[model samples]
Target chain A: MHAYANPARFLRIARWLMPALLAGGIVFAGGALAWGLFYAPAERLQGETVRIIYLHVPSAWLGMLGWGGIAAASFAEIVWRHPLAGVAARAIAVPGAVFTAICLATGSLWGRPAWGTWWVWDGRLTSMLVLLLLYAGYIALAAAAAASGANRRVAAVFGLVGAVNIPIIHYSVIWWNTLHQPPSLSLSGSSMAPGFMWPLLGSTLGFTLLFGAVVLMRMRMLLAGAQADSRLRRKALSAGEAA
Target chain B: MLKPKHQRMVLLAAALTALLAAVLIAAWALRHQASYFYVPSEIKAHPPEADRSVRLGGMVRRGSVHNEADGVTVDFIVSDGRADVPVRFAGIRPALFVEGSGVVAEGHMVQGRFEADNLLAKHDEKYVPREMAGMTAEQARQTVAQTK
Candidate 1:
């Protein structure tokens, strides 16, 4: 972990990993989309509209997963002050926000045909909304801190504090009455048939890979921007000293 | 007072505004396709104009269910216990949709009957998914007896 904490080494590894992960994500996502859309049986009730679940469920999973990634990265930044951890955390914010938006949008779409409402103020929906708001707030705070040259440690602390929402988001459905259905898949046992289960697993893996690729690419761009900014600042300081 | 950093912040604000605009427009465009729910009494009193898709929800009347010749399409009565409405849906019924059970039917009102394109079983506090909260003691016993 300490060896990988070096930004140069992390960048080197991510450079190769990003392309492979992106390619694999595209292939897997395409296959899952095809299987879910055409090959999988139409929900005996919902017909074609049920195919939306393939996209909706995966995006929702990634939204939560992206937040978990950010929290873990933030922890590393705060605890060990790992050089690249802050970058990892910062890089995830945009994609996390996008996934949260997708989750809410697609969930609303699914709800219309499935639940007969575009939105419900149910426990599950409310908690997911809170998750989106938290993501937005984190991004805003981090950006403010970055632009002001405020301490990154302070931003990392904020990240850690805000992460308390994760478990609440996870357990909200269980804790309160909700219109959303409970998770169909469980670690203890399989509730879904193999046809449904395999595609879901594939889609989840694809989504995870896609998240990693996007984060790595963003991190690269951020590192480059930071390096250029620091170089310009140093040159300006030297000129001021000479003057 | 507007420094380079302040200008960057303004740019971020503009980007956020654009993002919000895109999201709102997308939501609005899809609003008609979104789902709407109604109780059986509501459907009975104000049946939506023909061909407008909607959902009808209520308890399944005790003995009004009948298996159709096609076997897939079933005719049943949904009641608030005060007012009853007939529903015809050609699809697999949800596992929990039975007599005395709360149910939601999705489709449109056609002719005199509520023609459901989809069926969902709504559970009460007493009934939750087995995987999450597990079955109640009564349900557990019933399952055990069925296995034997």
Candidate 2:
């Protein structure tokens, strides 16, 4: 873990990993989406509408996972003062927000067909909405901190604090009498049939890989910017000394 | 007792733990408000004032759905096994709003019956493939009703 504290070394590793991850992500996400849309059997009750599960579940998973990543990176930034941790947290925010948005949109579409409403203030739905809002808030806070040249720890602290919502989002349906159903998948097993399960798993893996690739790409860009900024500063200092 | 960075880490963990505890307590205290709807037994036990609007949710009793003489109105009984609440709604029912399926109706109680302004269908977590369903739709309905 500490070996990655060196920016050049991190960039060296990510240079190769980024394209590999992207290619793998595209292959798996594309194949799974195709299978879910074209080949997966219709649900007994929901029919073709059930196909949305492939996108919705994975997006939901990543929405939470993204926050989890932010929390971990923030911890590293604060505790260990890991050099790349702030960059990693920043890189994760946009993709996390995007996934959260996708989850909400897909869930709304599914709800219209399955739940007879486009929106509801139920526990599960509301908490997921809150997760999206938290992402938005985090993005804005992180941006503001960056612009003002404020301490990045301000955003890292928020990242750590915001993590309390993840568990609430996870257990909302079970804790409250929600209109949305309980989770279809859990630690014990899944309620979904094998026909839907395989494609959903494949798509989830694909999306996760895609998410990682985006984060790495952003980190690389941020690191490159910092390195260039430092070199320019050094050049200016040398010029001033010569004068 | 620890390095400065380690001390900060411990403090951060404590603060987050306290925050989580606070959130959990607040949520627990407001659990009733967090619930989207009340079941029949809950309504019977508490019986909110007739004009105070609330959502009543449960399964539609298998044989209780009836279309009133008015073209717009439908009447049905929502049962949570132990109790039942009769509901009347004047709106287009959702495609999934079938007998023996879950429903949530929003409105107020009038005399004894619930007068619903909006109706939304609810579904269970089960997701069987069409081929694996084995039972006919009617049989599936009956099975759902029986499970209640």
Candidate 3:
């Protein structure tokens, strides 16, 4: 991993990797969405409203996974002080928040017909909302740190602390009798039939790939921007001395 | 090179202090602000504050829904198999709010009766994804009932 920490080398490889991930993500996600919408049968209880899960579930999963990545990167930043860890955390933040917002919006649309309400302040929903807020806070903190070139520890600490919500979101249904249904898929084995599970799994994979591609693209942009800024700063300093 | 040892130490201390503060605030808020709903069995075991808003979630008991002539005021019973709580609402009913399906209502107890201000229907047993298609709502309810 450290071998890729060299910015120029990383960018060289990422330039090729980004398009591959994007194309793969588009194909897989688009195919899964089409399959889920057109081919899957309507649920017995939810009827046609069940189609939203193809997008909603994956976004929700990515939302949580995004924070989990931040927490891990924060760990690296704080403990090992990995040169690329902070960049990785910053790259994941905005995309993660976007996915969280998508999850909430899609869940609301799905909820109207299925749950009868657009939004509920139930444990699961509330905790998920908090996760989104946490992402926003992290993004703002990352920006402030970048502007000041301050110690990255502040954001890393926030990243670690905000991770508390992830477990809470996962267990909210069990701890509280929420309107949101319990997770169908878990390590204990899924309650979902294979017919529905296959498409959902495919969509989740596609979304994860998309998320990875987005993060890589953001990291490369940040790297290039930093390089440009430093080059400009050196030129200005030399011109000042020459004058 | 890293920052001076003292600078690093101070920053680490500051971060720890901030983290501690956040943890304390979260714990305090969650204790008071978090609202957990109860099923009928749980409600019966220990009723919550009658004046405080709480959520009551369970299946809509079959044949218990009574729509008043006003068409806005409706009465129903929510059951968790072992116990039941009667809920009354004076509002527009949702299109999916029906008998023998899952429902969650937001309200507090009024003299042991739930006076719900809003209703949220639940898609219980829908995520199962097998034997659901071609089955009408009633048949699905019966299948769920038989399984219970």
Q: For residues B74-135, could you state the per-residue lDDT of candidate 3 as single tens digits?
A: 99999999999999999877766889888888898888789998888876533644475557
User: Which pairs of residues collide in candidate 1?
Assistant: A112-B35, A116-B35, A116-B36, A117-B35
Better of 2 and 3 by TM-score: 2
Q: Which stretches of candidate 2 lie over 4 Å from their true place?
A: B69-71, B134-148
Chain B, per-candidate TM-score: 0.61, 0.83, 0.63
Candidate 3, A82-122: lDDT as tens digits: 78899999999999999999999999998888777788888
| Preferred candidate (DockQ higher): 2 or 3 | 2
Best of the candidates, DockQ: 2
RMSD of each: 11.3, 3.9, 5.3
Clashes of each: 4, 0, 0
| Candidate 1: RMSD to truth | 11.3
| lDDT measured at residue B19 in model 1 versus the true structure, 0 to 100 | 56
Per-residue lDDT of B148 in model 2: 45
| Candidate 1: CAPRI quality band | incorrect
Fnat across every predicted model, in order: 0.00, 0.85, 0.44
Higher-ranked by TM-score: 1 or 3:
3
* Candidate 2 accuracy as lDDT: 0.91
